[model samples]
Target chain A: MQGIILSNETNALTLAELPKPTLKPGQCLVKLSAAALNRRDYWISVGKYPGIQPEVVLGSDGCGVVVDGPDTWKGKTVLINPNVNWGASEQHQSSDYSVLGMPTQGTLAEYIAVDEDRLMQKPVHLSDEEGAALPLAGLTAFRATFVKAKVTAGKKVLVTGVGGGVSQMAAVMAIAAGAEVYVTSSSEDKLNKARKLGATAGFNYQGAEWVKEAKSVGGFDAIVDSAGGNALNDYLKLIKPGGKIVHYGSTTGKPQELDLFRLFWSQASIIGSTMGSDREFEQMVAFVEEHQIRPAIDGVYALSSGVEAIERMADSSQFGKTVIRMEA
Target chain B: MQGIILSNETNALTLAELPKPTLKPGQCLVKLSAAALNRRDYWISVGKYPGIQPEVVLGSDGCGVVVDGPDTWKGKTVLINPNVNWGASEQHQSSDYSVLGMPTQGTLAEYIAVDEDRLMQKPVHLSDEEGAALPLAGLTAFRATFVKAKVTAGKKVLVTGVGGGVSQMAAVMAIAAGAEVYVTSSSEDKLNKARKLGATAGFNYQGAEWVKEAKSVGGFDAIVDSAGGNALNDYLKLIKPGGKIVHYGSTTGKPQELDLFRLFWSQASIIGSTMGSDREFEQMVAFVEEHQIRPAIDGVYALSSGVEAIERMADSSQFGKTVIRMEA
Candidate 1:
C-alpha cells in the first residue's frame, strides 16, 4: 500500500510503500478513497506537535470503502471519526482519548483499520474528497458553533480566520442554522469567497481598527475563533453582553491578555472546544446531510503529489480543505 | 430617615438625613434592619463604578421588615434581592437590569421602597446582619458554583481568594453540596478560617510554587475564582481536563496571559458570572435554608458608624461580610 509517511531521520513527509493494516474484532479495514490535510499534519511534519511518534502515518480525516471485517459495513462508504477512545463522559474527552493521526495509524494511506464504531456512512450528497474533508474540521466547527456557542436563527455570529477549514465550516454551519454569519480574514480573496459561501459580511482583520469597524456593525451574539492571541481582546470588545466566544485552535499562540473586567461585567464566556466526541461526530454528519452541505475543496492531489498538497497547506495558501486522492 | 450617602460635593460617604421613601403599586416599603457592604459599594465610593449617579444610595444587600404595602403581612422579615428589572431571559440579564444600589435608592437607608417580587423571607436561622450578608455574595457564589461550574457531590472544587465574600460563600456552598472543597488565600488567617468553614484543605497562594503544591494534592473538577490575573494560569494548571473555571470578579485585575493551548487541549472553560437572576436568587435562598447555612458576618457597625464599616471593607481588613445595623 502507498501512503505518505513522516520520516524520523529527515523529519520530512514522503510517499512511501507501507504494509497493509490488519483488522481486529470490532474493527473494520477501510480502503481509503481520499484523505484531507489539517494544520495538525503540518505541525507533526515540522515536529511541533506533542506525542510525535517516529514514522507515523499522518492525516485525521478520510472517506473510504469498507474492505474487510464487520460484515454489515463491508461494502459501505464511510467517513472516519478521527477521534478514538473518548471515555464515558459526554462533556469532554478522556485522558486516554486521542486523535487518530499521531500515535495511531491515520487515514492518509491506502487503507486504515479503525474501530467499527468510528465509521459513519458517508453523506451520499458529497463526493469522496468532500466526505474526507467533513470529519475533523466539520466536527470541530459543529461543536464550536452549535454545541459551544449555540448559534441559532436570528443570532449574529462571527467566524474568524475565514480562510481556514474550521472557520469556513463554522460559517457554513451557522448560515445553515439561520444565523446571520460574518467572517474575518487577512486576504480579500478569501473574504470574497466566504461572502459567496453565504456570509452576510466579511472584514479584513489586517485593516486598521478592524475591531472598531466590526463593532460599528453590531455586537456579535457568538464569535467562532481559531486564532487565540492579542486579538482575543478585540473579540471581547465585539461580543455582545452575555455572548460567547468559542475557540477551537490557538493558531497565533496563547492570548497575551484577557480583560477580566470586561469579560465578567459583560457576562461574556470563553469556551474551549477541540475535536468532537463520537456522538458529536454523528450529529455533525447528520447536520451536514440535513442541510445537504458540500464541503468546499481547495485542491486535490494524487498520493504521489502528497508533499505538494501538504506544502500548500503549510503555507496557508488554500482557502478550503486540501485533499489527497488515495485511489490515484 | 438616617442613611449613609455618597455626596457629589465631598466625594465621601457621610451620615445624612433623607426623606422617607414612599411605596407605589406592586411595591413595598421596608423598614431596613441591616445592610451589607460589597466591593461595588467601595468602587462607588471612589466614583470608579460605571453609571455613578450624584448622591446615590450605595448598599445592595439588606434584610428588612415590611413596614407598609401589601396586606399579606406587614411584619415579615425578608432579604432584598439586589438585582432588579431582570428581563425575561434565563441565559443573561436584560439591558435594563441593574444592581439595586448606585443609581437606584438602595438599602443603606432606614427605609427602602422595593418591588414586592424582590424580597425573600429571611432565613429563620439568621439574624438581620447575617441575612443581610447572604444576598449579594450568596447569589453570586450560587450562580458561579452551581450554575456555571456545576460543582457536585464528590467533585473536587477549588475556591480561589477565599477571604472575599463571594469566594468564601462559594467555598461554603460547594462544601454544603458534598464537594471536597479546597481554598486558596494570600493570608494564612483567611485560609485557616476557610478551613474552619468546611474546606477540605487550604493553600496559602503567597507561598512559592503554590501551583505545584496545589497540583500535588489533585486536579480540581471545578474552580470558583474571583481573583483573575497571573493566578488564572495557575488555575488552568490545577484544574482537571474539562473542568470549569467560573469567574465572578477580577479583583486582582484582568489576566495578563492565557495559554490557549492548555485551555483548548484540556477542554477547559472560563465562564463569567456576576449577580444572578431573580430565579437564581430564590434558588440560592432555598439552598441556604435547606443546608441551614449561616452566613459568616465579620462585625456589625451602627448606622452612625457606616463610614467606618465602608472604610473597613475598602481596606479589605474584614474576613467576612461587614454589616450596618439600621436600628442603632
Candidate 2:
C-alpha cells in the first residue's frame, strides 16, 4: 500500500510503499477513497507541531470504504473519527488521547486500519471529497460555535479568518442553525465568497476600522475565532455584553493582552474548544445531513501529488478544504 | 448625616457631615448599622478605579434597618444589594449598571437611599457585620463557582488567594455546595483559617513547588482565581481536563503567557465572572440562608476610622473582611 509518510530526518513528507495493516478485534480495515489537509498536517510536515513523530502517515480527515469490519459496517461508506483513546468522560479527552496521523497510522493511505467505533456512515448527500473534509474542520467548528458558544437562532455570530476551512465551516454551521452569521477576512474576494455562502455580512480585517464596522452591525452574540493574539482584545470590544468568543486554534500565537476589566465587567466568556466529542461528531453529521450541507472543496489533488496539496495548504491561500484522491 | 466621602481634589476619603438623603419614588431609605470594605474601595481612594466620582459614599456592602419604604419594609432588617441598575438580563448587566460606592452614593453614609428592590431580608442567623461582609464578595463568589463553574457534589474546587474576601467566600460556597474545596494562600495563618472554614486542604503558594503540591491532592475541577498573571499558566497545569478557571479580578495584572495549546487540547475554559445579576444576588442570599453560612469578619472600625480601614485593606494583611460600624 502507498501512503504519505512524514520524515523525521529531512522534515519533509513523501509518498512511500508501506505494508498492509493487520486488523485486530474491534478494528476494521478501510480502503480510503479520499483524505483532506488541515493546517496541523502542514505544520507537522515542517516540524513545527508538537509530538512530531517521523514515519507516521499524515491525514486526520478521510472518507473510506470498509472492507472488513463488524457485520453492520461491511461494505459501508464511512468517515473516520480521527480521534483515538478519548476515554470515558465527555468533559475532556484523556491524557493519552491522540488524533490520527501522528504516532499511530492514519488515513493518508490506500489501506488503513481503525477502530470500528471510530467509523460513521458518510452523510448520504456528500461526495467522498466532501465527507473527508467534514471530520476535522467540521467537528472543530461545530464544537466551537454550537457546543462552546451555544449559538442559536436569532443570535449574531462572527467567524474570523473566513478563508480558512474551520472558519468557513463555523459560518456555515451557524447559518444552518438559523443564526445571523458574519465573517472577517483579509481579502475582499474571500469576504465576498463568504457573503455568497449565506453570511449576513463580511468585513475586511485589514481595514483600519474593521472592529468599528463590525460593531455597527451590532455586537456579536458569539465570535468563532482561530487567530488568537492582540486581536483577542478587539473581540472584547465587538462582543455584546455576556457574549462568548470560542477559540479552537491560536494561529497568531498567544494573546498578548486580555482585558480582564472588560471581560468581567461585561460578563463575557472566552471558551477554548477543540475537536468535537464522539457524541458531538454524531450531532454534526446529523446536522449536515439534515441541512444537506456540502463542505466547500477548494482544490483536489491525485494521491501521488499529495506533496503539491500540502504545499498549497502551506501557502494559506485556499478558501476551503484541499483534498487528495487516493486512487487518482 | 455622617458619611465617608471620596474627595475629588485629593483622592482622599474623609468622614464629613452630609445632608440626609431624600427618597424618590420606588426608593427606600436605610439606616446603615454596618458596612464592609472591598479592595475596590481602597483602589478608588487612590484613584486607581475607573469612574470614581467625588462625594460618593464609598461602601458597596452594607447591612442596616430599612427605616423608610413601602408598607412592607418600614422596620425590616435588610442587606443592600450594592449593584444598582442591573437591568433585565440574566446573562449580563445592562450598560447603566453601576456598583454602589462609585458614581452613585453608597452605604458608607449613616443613611442610604436605594431602590426598594435592592433590599433583601438579612438572614436571621447573621449579625450586622457578617451580613455586611456578604454582599459583594458573596455575590461574586456565588456567580463564579455555582453559575460559571457549575460546581456540584464531590467536585474538586480550588480558591486562590484564600485570605481575601472573595476567595474565602468561594471556598465557603463551594464547601456548602458539597464540593471538596482547597485553598491557596501565601500566609500559613490564612491557609489554616481557610481550612477551618471547611476547605479540604490548603496550599501555601509561596512555596516553589506549590503546583506539584496541589497536584498531589488532585487536579482541580474548578479554580476560582483573582490573581491573573504568569501564575495562570500554572493553573492550566493544575486543572483537570475540561475544568474551568473562573476569574473575577486580576490583582496581579494581565497574564503574560497563556498557553493556548494546553487550553484547547485539554478543553479547559477560562471564564470571566463579576458581580452577580439581581436574580443571582437573590439566589446567593437564598443559598446563604439555606447553608447558614457566616462570612468571616477580620476587624471592625468605627465610621470615623474609615481612613484607617482603607489603609489596612491596602496593606493586604487582613484574613477576611474589615468592616465599619456606622454608628461608632
Candidate 3:
C-alpha cells in the first residue's frame, strides 16, 4: 500500500510504500478510491499544528469501497467520516476522537483502517472524487452554518473567503436551506463562481469596504467567517442586532480587539463550530440528496499528486473541492 | 408613574415622577411588582458599556401584572422576556415585543409598555423577586448551554465564575439536564453555594490550574465561560476534541495568545451566545416551571436604592440574583 507521509517539521511530503492496515474488530479496511485536501492538512504537514504524529498518513476526507468489515458493512461503497475516537475511549470522551491526518493515520493511501461506525454509504450518484470531498469540508460547512448559526429561510448570511472548500459548501448548502447566501472572495473569478452557484450576491473582498458591499445586499443575520482575522471585526459590525458571527477557522489568528462590549450590547454572538456530528452529517446528506445540490469539482489528481492538491489549498486559488483519485 | 433613572454617569438613581406609559394597540402596559438587576444594568448605570440613553429606565428583567391590553391579555400575571428588537423603525413591527432594557426601554420603571406577545405567564409558584430574576441570566444560560453547546446527559461541563447570575443558572440547569457540573469561583464560599445547586465538583479557581481541576471531573464536554481572560486560554486546553466552549462575557478583557491551533486540530469549538429568542424564552420558562428551579435571590433593595444594587454587582461579593422591590 502507498500513502503520503509527513515525516518531519517544515518539509515537503514523501510518498512511501506502507504496510496495509489491519482492521480491528469494529474497524473497516477500506480500499480508497479518492481523498480530499484541506487547510488543516497543510498546517499539519508543516508541524505548525502539533496534533499530527510523524509517519501518519495525512488525509481525513476519502471515499472507498469497504474491502472487509462487519458483515453488515462489507462490500459497501462509503466515505470515511474521519473523526475516529480510538478505542480507550467511549462515546464522546472528548480526548478520544482524533481527526484524520492529525493524531491518527488518515486516508491518502491504498488501504486504510477505520471504525466501521465512521463509514457512511456514499451516494451512488456522486463520483468517488465528490464522495471524498463531501465529508470533512461538507460536514464543517453544515455544522458552521445550520447547526451552529441555526440559519434559516430568508436570513441574510455572508460566507467569507468563498474560494475555500468549506465556505463554498456552506454557501451552496445555506442557499438550499432557503437562506439568501452572499459570498466574498479576494478574487473576482472566485466571486463569479460563487455567484453562479446560487449565491444571491458576490463581492471581491479585496475592496476596502467589502463588508459594506455585503451589507448593501441586506443586513446579515449571521456571518460564516471562514476568514477569521481582520474581516472578523468588520464581520461583527455587519450582522443585525442579536445576530451571530459563527466561526470554524481562525485563518487569520486569535483576533485582537474582541470588543466584548459590542458583543454584549448588540446581543450579537461569536459562535465557533467544527465538523458536523454523525447526526448532522446524515441531515446534510439528506438535504443534498433531496435538493440535488452538486458539489463543485475543481480538478482531480492521482493519489500520487496529493502535494498538488495541498498546494491548491495553500494558494487558495481553487474554487471548490480538490480531490486525489485513488482508482478509477 | 415612577421609574429609577440614571440622571448621569455614577449619579445616584432617583425615583422620579413620570407620565405612565400609554399602551399602543396590541400593547400591554405592565404594572410593576418587582424588577431584577443584572451586570448589564450596572454597566449601563456607569455608562461604561454605552448604549444607555440618559434618564432611560434601567431594568432588563422583571415580572409584573398587565394592567392594560386586549381582553385576552389584560389582568394576566406575566414575566417580561428581555431581548427585544425596536419595532418603531421596522414597521409591521410587533407591538407585543418587549426587551425590558437594551435598545428598547426597560422594566425598572413603575410601568413599561410592551407588545402583548412578549409576555409569558408567570410561573404559578414563583415570587415576583424570583420571577424578575429569571429572564436575562436564565435565558442566556439556557441558550448557551442547551442550544449552543448542546450539552446533554452524562456530559462533563464547566461553569466558570459561578457567583454571577448566568453561571448559577448554568450549573443548576446543567445539573437538571443530567450533566456533570463543575463550578469555578475564586471564592470558596461561592464554590459551596454551587455545590448546593448540584455541581458534582467545585474548585476555588483563585490560583488553581482549572484545566487540571476540570480534568479530575472527567474533562469538560462543554465549558460555559463568563469569566474570560487568561483563564480562557487554559479552558481552551481542557475541552475534549469536539467539545464546545460557549463564551458569553469576559469580565477579563480579551486575553492575547488564544491558541487557535489547538482549536482547529482537535476539532473543538468556542460558541458565543447571548440572550434567547421568544421561542427559547418560552422553553426556558417551561423548564423552570417543570423543574421548580428556584432562582437564588442574593438581596432585595428598595426602588430608591437602585444605585446600591449596581454598587453590589460591582463589589462582586454578592451571590445570586439582586432584586428591586416596588411598593406592594
Evaluate all candidate structures by whole-model CA lDDT and list the values in order: 0.88, 0.89, 0.79
TM-score, candidate number 1: 0.95
**How good is the docking of model 1, as DockQ?**
0.70
Shift of residue A50 alpha carbon in model 2, Å:
2.4
In model 1, which regions exceed 4 Å deviation? Answer: none
* Cα-based TM-score, every candidate: 0.95, 0.97, 0.76
User: Across residues A132-184, which tens digit of lDDT does each residue of candidate 2 receive?
Assistant: 99998998988999889999999999999998989999999899999999999
Order candidates by lDDT, high to low. 2, 1, 3
Candidate 2, residues B1-328, lDDT tens digits: the string is 9998877667688888999999999998999999999999988878789887888788899999988879799899999997888888888888888899878888887999989989999999999999999999999999999999889999999999998898889899899999999999889999989888889889998899999999998799999998887888899899888899889999888887677778887788888898889999999999999999998889999999887888778768888799999885
The most accurate candidate by DockQ is: 2
lDDT of 2 at A94: 76
The DockQ of each candidate is: 0.70, 0.74, 0.23
Over the stretch B53-171, how does candidate 1's per-residue lDDT look in tens digits?
86767799999899998977479999999988877877678888899987799988899999898888998989888999999999999999999899999999999888788888888
lDDT (10s digit) by residue, model 1, range A248-294 = 99989887789988888788899889887889989999999999987
- Strongest candidate by TM-score: 2
Query: Which pairs of residues collide in candidate 1?
Result: none
